[model samples]
Target: MLNIKNLQVGLEEEDKQILKGVDLNIGEGEVHAIMGPNGSGKSTMSYVLAGKGGYEVTGGTATLNEVDLLEMEPEERAAAGLFLAFQYPVEIPGVGNMTFLRTAVNAQRKARGEDDLSAGEFLKVVRAKAKALKIDADMLKRPVNVGFSGGEKKRNEILQMAMLEPKMCVLDETDSGLDVDAMKLVAEGVNALRDGKRSFLVITHYQRLLDHIKPDVVHIMADGKIIKSGGPELALEVENNGYADLLAEVA
Candidate 1:
């Protein structure tokens, strides 16, 4: 569903490259995870794919279902069915969560030429989705991510994902700062969206999250490129040993 070829990205201002010759293909209905150490460009790839600014595409192409994602605006990418859940979800203190979600959902729908959900419809759907993520009414009534614990913020992001129902999802370290129970809840929310058609690219630093999510393919990225890829066992290997052996082999 997502195809990235020789993806090369560099900072827009500086003379430095973050992603160099990264290529990956994720078929529809598949879950793929990228595990790497800090500064390995895992998060950078996520931002680039989402059409975030400050990163210039020096080379390569990224497409969603064959649509050129690199050429589209961030909102256009979203309307085209691309969703990014940030590692640190920003808190919009003044805006209500309902307002933020409905506005976003409406914007996406409007961009897609679909009718926006009515207040009643949105309330019904969001309440259902929020409940599934274990989000309480009080939490939803508050400003987005404002005063929420780390787990709450992450869960709020998942709720956003569940509402949007994008074709491709890129989660940047959804496991970060989450406790065991919080992680499980977030995973459940993510797993609920895996319907054999929607695809996921999960970027993380550790393998424990894979235990719940169970990626179909696990990729090891180092120094801005994928060094090795294997099945779930690859993650197990990294967990048991480390990236040391793999990096040495590649060296």
Candidate 2:
């Protein structure tokens, strides 16, 4: 579960605020979607939770299962079971995908005082997870996200998520640059990870993605704050009416 209260963030390099007061709670096993127009601080919130730099927390707090997220390093956050899938997954030109994954997995395990997976164990598990995502062996041998299409990159991200088995997941515009089929594939990978104990916060602009991954609750964020929340029908309403009506009502 995740709890954020009046979370405020501003650009580290400038004098501008991104998240004014984002207060939201996601219970265990619940899927929540955040839909908002551009520059509404949707992605900013994700970055802040992931502990990415260049964003200073000006106010409020965020916690994961009662642990203060704002106080931890990015790697510490990951070790604490927080996974973030970026809209645009960056390429590590020379790092092999498998190498990156194994290292990360082992690092997290070490951080948690768990034993590292042997090479065989890691290979077995990763191959199984990769096959489900349709990630080929050649792709895994290549550098992370290097030469991969948009869908491939997103699928790789899901594979990372599946491998990590994080407690809370924040997907920032995972639907971006993905076609319908790619979206479904990615969504399927995400859905497979849902086990009634993991929480998800999906940030997106379109309803097509939501159609694939149904959210238990849908929130509308504007002006850096979550302005409205409802059942899955809220996404349908946004699709039908757009955020104009919601923004107007909130104003």
Candidate 3:
């Protein structure tokens, strides 16, 4: 479970506020989608939650299972069950995908006071999870995201999610780039990880991703605040009518 209360964040250098007293609570096993306009602070919320730099929390608190998240480093947050799939995955030239993944997994495990996975164990698990994401051996052997197609990069993100199996997954615009088939493939990979124990926060611009992920709740964000919360139908409204009317009504 994740809980945020009166959360306010701003750019560190600019000192300009982005999230203005945003509040949200996600129960276990729930998928919540955040739909908003370009400057609505949706990605800002995700970045802050993942402990990315350049943002300062000016007010309020966020917690995961009652653990204060704002105090942890990014890797500490990841070790505490936070996984963020970026809108634009960066390329790590020369770092094999498998090596990156194994290092990450072991680092988190060590952080949590668990032993590193044996080479054999690591290989077995990565292979199984990669196969599910349709990641071929060749792809795994290649440097992380280096020269990967957009779809492949996104799929690799999902594979990382699967391998980590974090309790809370925050996907920031994971649907930003993809063909119809590629989108479907990525969605299927996401759906396959859906069980009654993990929670998801899906931040997306379009309802097309929601059509596949099928969030349990949908939220409309505007002007750095969540103005309305509803069911899946809310996404359809945005899809059909756009945010102009919603913004007008809220205004």
Q: Pick the candidate with the highest lDDT.
A: 2
Weakest 10 consecutive residues of candidate 3 by summed lDDT:
126-135
Task: State every prediction's TM-score relative to the real structure.
Answer: 0.99, 0.99, 0.98
Candidate 2 clash figure, as a count: 0
Q: Global lDDT of each model?
A: 0.95, 0.96, 0.95
Considering TM-score, which of the candidate structures 2 and 3 is the better prediction for this target?
2
- Clashes (N, CA, C under 3 Å) per candidate: 0, 0, 0
Identify the runs in model 2 with alpha carbons over 4 angstroms from their true place.
none
Q: Looking at candidate 1, what is the lDDT of residue 67? A: 93
Supply candidate 2's per-residue lDDT for 57: 98
Q: Residue 235 CA error for candidate 1 (Å)?
A: 0.3
Query: In candidate 2, which residue pairs get closer than 3 Å at backbone N, Cα or C atoms, i.e. clash?
Result: none
Q: What TM-score does candidate 3 get on C-alpha atoms?
A: 0.98
Q: Ten consecutive residues with minimal summed lDDT in candidate 2?
A: 178-187
Model 1 regions lying over 4 Å from their true place: none
Ranking by TM-score: 2, 1, 3
